[model samples]
Target: MTTATVPAPSTRADAPSASSAYRLSFGHLLRSEWIKLTTLRSTWWSIGLVALVSIGLSLLMATSLASFAGDVPPMPVVEANRQAVQVVVFSTVLTQLLAMILGTITVTGEYSTGMIRSTLTAAPGRVAALFAKAIVLAVTMFVSSVVVFTAAALVSGPILPTGPLDLGYPDSSVLPVLGAALYLALIAVMGVGVGFIIRNGPGALAAGIGLVFVAPILVMFFPRVESFQWIHDAAGYLPSNAGQSLFMGSPMTGITLEPAPALVTVLAWTAVVIAGGIAVLKTRDA
Candidate 1:
């Protein structure tokens, strides 16, 4: 009896799976976004800048705390937590600068290099493509913010030679710490939305940075002007100001708002920007 030799198992090169040839699925989209994010040198640079500024400023604060010790009462552990939250969240300025670059890259870079056409073609639903990128960018920003803030707290702690900075206090810290991270991520998403609307790298960058820095300046400078008070109210609801409220544990010197309301305001801004971007994306050609 002659038995035919069993055929060799098909090699992947010989018979590729359907997955290798399929269009973008949710998972595939996520993976593609991840690739796009990590492949860019700008992303790494932005994240690194955030880490450096946060930790450096934290150490500076710790060093300066000694001067305040004389006139001010010894900071309570809760007060210390508040201070740390301020340092970490305010350092998100660096994160925002970098995130603006990232946002510019994420949307405008695609258009710059003519890759967005391919992206939309693969996904076939502009919203789906946008959603995938949004999910990836948001998660990445949140995680990085958490890591940088935690490191800042740790590094700053040891600078106070007398009393150790204790991050262990769960009561006043945990929520604020989390809020800081969420705020940064939300800012990043909002930046992405700005990019989608502007669709020009320089334009997006300027608009994003201006919305953060210039808008607040204009609002505060002209708050007394009747036409500008409305601008103040609108600017007050911006991501930077609203999100900064998460760190305003101490009594405000100039402006004040409750953290919960601030959070809601920031979320509303995020929603409006994102909706605007979606509308623009639907109408514009790549």
Candidate 2:
């Protein structure tokens, strides 16, 4: 009886296994984080607000300075260039708040929506996932900041007074603008760390605001009190103050740190915050 021969299933040696097919790489995690960041409606709104604030403020400052250019004596080339750069970056004080909020939401939103579990499950390595998120956030914020600053420079160029205010002079504008973008990127990274630690949208936002905004104001008072002189001295090392020095190319009033020290201060703050977040992420359940 020559019955029908049953054929056995073939397993090719080169075929991918289930585990190998599903394994996620660092690139995959970064791509996934970018996708998530871009897909959110809030991201667009925050970016739009940043642009509006930056450009609008720049125009206002340029117009005002131009009006007074006739009455004022000609300033030194270096001082005028510094002032011009400051005009473009003036809105950073407000725009940073938006950056902080956006950053906080980037991570906390995932937790709020219960998407974090799926993210962790897919990535498996929590630290890598956090790093991916931070990298994405930093890159996005930096690029957006640079674009906004460039647009502001272009829009304000015609309005600014001749000589130092001229955007045509690339000497002072380029590095300061780049530094401003870097500062915003670092601020966003700090927000991500805050979000990871807090894990609640509103809470994280408040924490970010307090750190970047309120804390500076609160510390400002300490310097005025004789007993709190030490705290006042420490205020120059604050992230916001240091960041100001970084973008401004000079220390703000009462801030002692120069550009180099300011950069170090900001980096230290970011590193400490991120390390704390990683510790929390490692110890706690998602």
RMSD to the true structure for each prediction, in A, is 6.4, 3.9
lDDT of 1 by residue, 124-156 (tens): 668878878888998998899888888887776
lDDT for 183 (candidate 1): 75
lDDT of 2 by residue, 1-286 (tens): 6879644434666666667956688989999999999999999999999999999999999999899878878777667778878988989989999999988899999998899999999877799999999999999999999999988888887777754354555667677888889999999999999999999989998988988877878875554666877776777787888888787865443357777788899999999989989999999999
What are the models' TM-scores?
Answer: 0.84, 0.89
Off by over 4 Å in 2: 1-22, 162-171, 223-227, 250-254
Q: What's the TM for model 2?
A: 0.89
- Judged by whole-model lDDT over C-alpha atoms, candidate 2 comes out at 0.85
Instruction: Show the lowest summed lDDT stretch of 10 residues, model 1.
Output: 248-257
Assess each prediction's global lDDT (C-alpha) against the native.
Answer: 0.74, 0.85
Residue 168 error, candidate 1, Å = 5.4
Count of clashes, each model:
0, 0
Global fold similarity of model 1 (TM-score): 0.84
Worst 10 residues of 2 by lDDT: 162-171
